[model samples]
Target: MRIMLIGRWGKTHALAKALAASRDVELYSLMDKKNTGIASLSAHYELGNIKDLSVIQKFVEKHRIDMLFVVPEMSLARGITDYFNEKGIPAVGPSEFCTKLEGDKGFVRNLMKENHIDHYPDFHVFSDKKEAVEFIRNYSRPFAVKPSGITEGDGVKVMGIQLINKQEAMDYVEQIFDRSIGGMASVIIEEKIEGEEYTIQLFCDGKTVVPMPVVRDYKLLEEGESGLNTPGMGSVSYPNHLLPSLSKNNFDESVVIMERILDVLKEKYGEKYNGFLSGQFMLTEQGIRVVEINVRPGDSEILNIIPILQTDFMDICRAMANEKLDEIKISFAEKSTVCIYAVPEGFPTPSGKVQIHIDRKRFEKPGIHLFQSCFEAGESLYEPSPRLFAVTGTGDSLEEAREKCLEGLSGIRGKNIFYRKDIGTRDLAERYMKKYDLPGV
Candidate 1:
């Protein structure tokens, strides 16, 4: 089967590696605004972003592509699948109807309540900043200032760090009113629950779902949750696809939540919701509460989850195409995976320019995998991408896996290149583990 993967920088490099080891499947090509990972792939690749439906349709028709798999938020939010269906080509990804889950966090929170899905905290949804400001000034309890629509990653400020005193929160609320930042006119004042957060990802075909490994993705740029949030920094998947301290009951509840939401999405929307459905949840003293959901695959999280998969990547794609997700079997090895992202010195903000060089031979070693995001190379070593590359390490234990990642990252040479030292480490993961053991119940 000829498969065209629609992603700028995801498991493109890793998928290329898997396809090379498989039979009867061809990596048709890739189209991304940047050629970071696409440039390194063995198959043909074109440079174009996942925007503009006309551009994608023309490319698919030109190649006579049999199947299409997309992984970007913008393209999916714009209804790429609906466009592909009209053109008679089978596409895999959330449709315009399904993307509302991620595109509008406020909507999902209400949907959960309407469906009687428990664990959602009491919240107020409002459009005007004046309304939110009034609530913040009067409400005594600490809460999170969040945007009702998509923030990409910004726009949400927690109570302690980002939201300092009541005055600072009022200022943040004013910022939300500004239409320039993601055009977020509405905001949600969510009750901020104290707990540790982990993401549960499942593969769904309109009717059934195959749960992939549960992984934790770090958003903080610094070691101790200090720094502005980007889409993601890195992630870790422990043995058995669950964390050390998370109880079996909590894990099972998350699965049931996903199943119930899947049913609701299929029933609420006429079209079947396909592709990745991720629930970013926090395990708190009150119980497990979902933060939000992403219709597409989590960017950095995919680094660890895809590498150790025993299922053929193409098989999953094919099953998704025919809406036969139940037929596809998923399994993860006992080995743990640690994924690290290397970014330009100015990551969350000003991403300065620098040249990044890596030894392909060093990356070829066992347990080390690299996926390029956005680094440009020239005769004299020119500018670098904001986010350069991702390095992954796999081992029997989390510590060994993390060490492999750190050692492999050393081989990546660049100026103004920095990565979080604490991501996926035992100490950092344990910090969240301790939250579950808190005394206040």
Candidate 2:
């Protein structure tokens, strides 16, 4: 099978690694920008804007590509899948209209309310700054303020964490209206559901849904869960496929909610949802509450889960393309996985790019993998805008995985590079459990 993978990020690098491992697969890549790691792995590499259908169409025709593995949500939002599928090329992703589940927060909130999907948080969408401020001022409880559109996971501000008080929340709404944050001048004020957050990613073929291992993603930039929110800093998955603080019932409930949402997309909206769907859920006192829905795989989360997958990934992609996902039984290895990202010192605030150095030969050993998120600036020099790369480790136990991940990360040397030292550790897990008053493993 000849495949063309889209997008330019750490996830693209990870997917390229998985696809290149199959001898029958000829991997090709079309990146909006240059990514040396992805370029190195592809049989053919093209630099073109992924949102431009003309560029992609020409590439597909030139290569006679059999399958497209689209990664970025922005490309999906641009209707790349719909365009290519009409041309008889199978694209592994959701359509443009279907991407509203992640692209538009207001759409999702209303869908949940209209469909009576359980676990929907209290929320109100607003376009007027005055009305939004008035609503937040009178609300008695803490809430979260979010841009109605995608902000690459940095637009949300929760009360008591990002925003200190109601006044701050109101100020944020005003800022959103003035600045048009998240590419829109609208805001979503949602009742904050406080708990430990975890991600549930499922593969869908417009009918069948296969769930992957549950992953806990750390969004905060600093240790002890302090600092600004990033796309992701690190993530962890256990052998049991459930976090220590999460119950099996809650885990299953999260999957059921995703399935329900997919059903609504098909029945009510006439949109058959395909590709990867991830529900970011919180295990609150009231059971499971969904934080948001993602149309693509989570960045750091995918890094951990893909390494432990026991089944052939190419087969899964083929099944998704053919809408025969139910024909295959998916499975994963009984192993714990850990992924930690290394970023520049002044991340989320934006600083000058720092030079990065890595010894690729050192990672030939077992249980250690490296995926690049940075770009090459010069000979033997790399630069990181936010995250540079990720080091993943797998083992029979989480502790062993954490140790190996740290050991693998040691080979990556860069001035002012930072990574959390406590990811996939017992201390961090216990701290989170205590903070939420949840029972530990």
Candidate 3:
């Protein structure tokens, strides 16, 4: 399996590491701005952005990259995947048009309204602060202001009543402008849906779509979901909650929204437009409403779902690349797994290098998988950095998994290190599992 994975750095780093252990898999090349610690494993390294199609073409030909696995950077990833597909290379990703469903919030909102795919109240798009203020004045407070682009939960800010003042809203718009360029200045302001949120990830080879076990992610930095929003702090999936309801779960509405969204994509975009797909949903009194769509894999969510995947990850990718997904049957682990993300203090930005010491033996019990993240040193001693590594634990129940994850992470010692202590807990996972009312503690 020769695969060309494209992303910024950290994502590519994790992808290469996950695929390296496969005996049949060979990482052909990696295209990124800098070395994401994948140079040691990748057969060839192309040091440049994916926007350079000329360089991408040369690298693909030189290394014979069989398939392209695009990580999160969707705007660029979508464009690169589109370029490769146009060149007649076997690629697995949504088409540029389908990706726009995620790239442009305006487009998505319009689609949802047109299709009557569940609604979360009214939303307005703004290019100027004055018009935005007028719209807010005409309506309610406590709204959600989001950048049309930049998914993975970035560019989303939920304002409370007090924060909805005109000056604060203008400041936020200015911040969005600073982060955006070109016509990206447009922002999506919507009525904030009140309720718990959940993430539903789907795998599609363009046609037969399989929804992964629903996983819950803690988007905030601290407990009670109060703090600055990072990409993803941690995540866990409660299979117990999902088993009862492909039928009767409260989240059945979420599944409906996902199916509806996929239907729209297949109908509007071609069924051959394949790759990973994700749906973010909110469960409210009105039912589950679509929050956003992600065209590629969601990192923290993937960590939770992958263990349950009984099928071979490489085989599925190969089948997608070969256009034989119909012939492949995917299965998942009957047991449960939990994944916890650990980061250094002042993280989501550069902090100084820190040292991490771990008592490997203490947490090396059965059903534990440790994934290395922002570690910079050797196997024995993990030299500290902004992010260190992820510790995942698996057991018969969510509680057991939480215990293992907590214990495993406790073994590691590092200064300026911080992690959500509530990962895998019942209360933490309950909000996400609510829709699927199987059995709860």
The most accurate candidate by TM-score is 2
Off by over 4 Å in 3: 8-18, 21-23, 29-47, 75-78, 161-166, 178-183, 241-253, 269-272, 357-365, 375-387, 429-440
- The residue-by-residue lDDT of candidate 3 on 1-441, one tens digit each, is 687876644445555756665567778654444343566667666666565667777878888777777665544444777788777786767767777767787878887888887554578888775676567666655688788876445567777632547567667767776667323767888887765566777777665666777776677788756677777777776656352223346556666676676687668755455777787776666666777878777767776766566677777776766667779887777666677778888866667666777677865587665555554444444443345667777778877877887878888787778888887766655654465443444
Instruction: State the lDDT at 282 in candidate 3.
Output: 64
* TM-score of candidate 3 to 2 decimals: 0.85
Candidate 2 structure, TM-score to reference: 0.98
> Tens digits of per-residue lDDT for model 2 on 1-441?
889999889988988988888758999999866789899999999988888888988999999999999999888999999988888989999999999998899999899889889787889999888999999989987789999988877889999888988888888898898888987878999998988899999999999999999999999988988878888899999999998888788888889999999999999889998899989999898878889999998998999988987778898998998889999989999899999999888887766667777888768889999998877778756766468889999999999999989998999887888899989889999998999999977
- Give the range where candidate 1 is weakest over 10 consecutive residues by summed lDDT: 377-386
TM-score of 1: 0.93
Candidate 3 worst ten-residue window by lDDT: 239-248
List pairs with backbone clashes in candidate 3.
250-435, 251-435, 308-333, 310-331, 310-332, 354-384
Name the runs in model 1 displaced over 4 angstroms. Answer: 11-22, 29-32, 377-385, 435-441
Candidate number with greatest lDDT: 2
Q: Which 10 consecutive positions of candidate 2 have the poorest summed lDDT? A: 377-386
Instruction: Write down the RMSD of candidate 1 (Cα, Å).
Output: 2.5
* TM-score list, all predictions: 0.93, 0.98, 0.85
